[model samples]
Target: MNELPSIEQIASCVSGYDPNALPVAQAQEFIARFVTPVAAVESIALRATLGRVLAADVVSPIDVPAHDNSAMDGFALRGADLAAEGDTRLRVVGTGLAGQQFDGAAPARGECVRIMTGAVMPPGLDTVVPQEFTRSDGDVVVIPAGAVRTGDNRRLAGEDLARGEAALTAGRLIRPADLGLAASLGRAELPVRRRLRVAFFSTGDELRSIGEPLDAGCVYDSNRYTIHGMLARLGVDAIDMGVVRDDPAALEAAFRAAADCADAVITSGGVSVGEADYTKQTMAKLGEVAFWRIAMRPGRPMAIGRIHAAGPGSKAAVLFGLPGNPVAVMVTFYAFVRDALLRMAGAAPEPLPMLSARSAEAIRKKPGRTEYQRGRVVRGADGDWHVSLTGAQGSGILRSMSQANGLVVLRHEQGSVAAGERVDVMPFDGLV
Candidate 1:
């Protein structure tokens, strides 16, 4: 519930800054400073909480295991009874299954109990010798010396989660493992943030929808499809507003409708200086928009602002105007929009780790702009991983993005790279 610093205050912190040509890191920081997590919360069934952000911290009401239990199918006995240098023979008094425990008192001295995995530890027993390490003859079991030490294979109560402990904190995006943990804690329901609603559309007279017949000069709108898939991966409630023509009135209507209903409005195309399309003009009419030429390859032109509805008492929606090129749209989305959307959806900020790998070929580059080249990483027989750039690094090359498994990131000051040189890569498929 803390207030975020104003944009002017944030910008004052950056040195040698120029809004005309912003640094990638500085732009990210600007966007991050403007984000405020959503406050709406809802309680739903545990299974349905997957992919939703936790609204409150989940405290364990009881110990995780609730009792001391055996971690393996073995013989449970007092560790002190085992001979230090020789085998110990003892009579097995009872058997313990996962859900059932020995009914009588603890086994007498020189006696042991056969225990299954998850079975509660019998009283006075503090260790278990796995069944593989023991020999059984009728009711007699022989435990080898030093097979297991005290507390070995015996899971103590609350070992995983202690009662009254914070099992999962707020702002966490619930995952499968988290759901299982909640169920283990006897929680049938959970409180999670409401899903963020994102509405997006493509702007271009030459862009056609899937069902429309393609003309000689027009291309099917793949940007909307790509954007839809990417938004789905973020678990947002996506509102797909079909392509809007490059007209001021049509663009204004789309922006207003999107701002009225959704938390964010994302548009691809008409932000670049050359495009000169009416998108910029229409966005200016609706809200305060800034066009920036970021020092980055594939995606340099971007517009960001907050669009307000026409009527009073209406909430404003964040706007992201991305470049029109197929690959550029995706790059900008991943680099900027993804993180902004996550923060807006009530999830805590967690940076994705960049992995290092060797380059398979020399790459051309400039020293000023940052570059994110699509790459296909493979493991060599030498037990090392190397990455080769996709056939084309052009902004328009959609195939390059499709064929790549990761993006080889070159920093702003980095120059051309030599073959077999180490590079940082952000993989596509992994926990984010």
Candidate 2:
């Protein structure tokens, strides 16, 4: 356990750290500065590494190809044998298949060998003309005048990756392709950062867990399910603590238990102003915390800091107090908690890819606060991507989020946009 700087110290270092009306970017930076990566590493099988973070650089143990090989199924011959003006014919000495090297006598001066893709380039063969390019007359193959030049269609030893070269870097988020890369290097196991255990629950007296009977004026807690799904995508161990009613003792106990068992704690609801919930008070009583009215729409109220378990020398967990609205919870997760959790899990800092899309309709936006509106993006007749709002974008409306494939990001310092104007879109296509 390392000594982390107090939240006050972190805020003081920021240029304009205001708890009220803080810009989205500033809040991101403040959280980034305060959170630290977990220092545990474990070696796991390649199959289990998807979404895990690499703890160390992976250097290639051997050349990728290991030897000069053929990249196409063709006839292998010396480049000089290729005529510059007319066709050149050569005798076929033998045939080589992939993984079966040609072991017979090397072709004499005017001879060639038929080779398949992945077959090791035989001695003295420096070029491969696609089998389709050459005409077969009896046992000889004819090459056209300009079919290929020296080194055409030949994969050299270490051409793709050299031995001892860094193949995969540290802090890389493991994807399926990365697993293939590691497997190509003959790695059965990979060193990855241990997954962070995160505990989360909903805070509201009117909230009920699924399968529980809904009372008058109460709703089921959907934020936990969303939080669980999001955490699963990040490859973290998510602990759903269910809903905590507006009781001080229960809230305090939940916070302590969550902190004691996990690296971070998330609570959706009861972080807003003038809420009769005891979540805010319980958080302050446990550890260092600050509430922020972030300058963002769809999600604004946020609490970030650390909370420790009961007893001396207790481990502290990073806290993320999100707003109650179902849509607000998801929006705030993507904007803030996603990055913070990635950092805590020891993954590299990677911004979600945002693409440009033209607006299908006029959108009203203010300059100071950032707004994320649910949008369905599609290709317009002009062949460029265009986005239209998902109907009824209230924060409590989860159906609007379900209908959206992306968030039309109207950035801070940018105002209203007219139809056909270009805007940035944070797509959800590959976030899974």
| Best-fitting candidate, scored by TM-score | 2
Given candidate 2, what's the lDDT at residue 177? 94
Q: Model 1 over residues 259-295: C-alpha lDDT tens digits?
A: 9999999999999987758999888888767788999
Q: How does each model score on TM-score?
A: 0.95, 0.96
lDDT of 2 by residue, 1-432 (tens): 457888889999988999998998899889999999999999999999888999999999999889898899999999888877989999999988998989988777888999999999889999999999989999989888888998999999998899999999998898889999999999999999989999999988888888999999999889999899889888899999988888999999999999999999999988899988788998988888999999999888999988989943587899999999999999999999999999999977788999899998999998999999999999978889999999998999999899999999998899999998999999988662
Extract clashing residue pairs from model 2: none
Query: Model 1 Cα displacement at 242 (Å)?
Result: 1.2
TM-score of 1: 0.95
Local distance difference test scores for all models: 0.89, 0.91
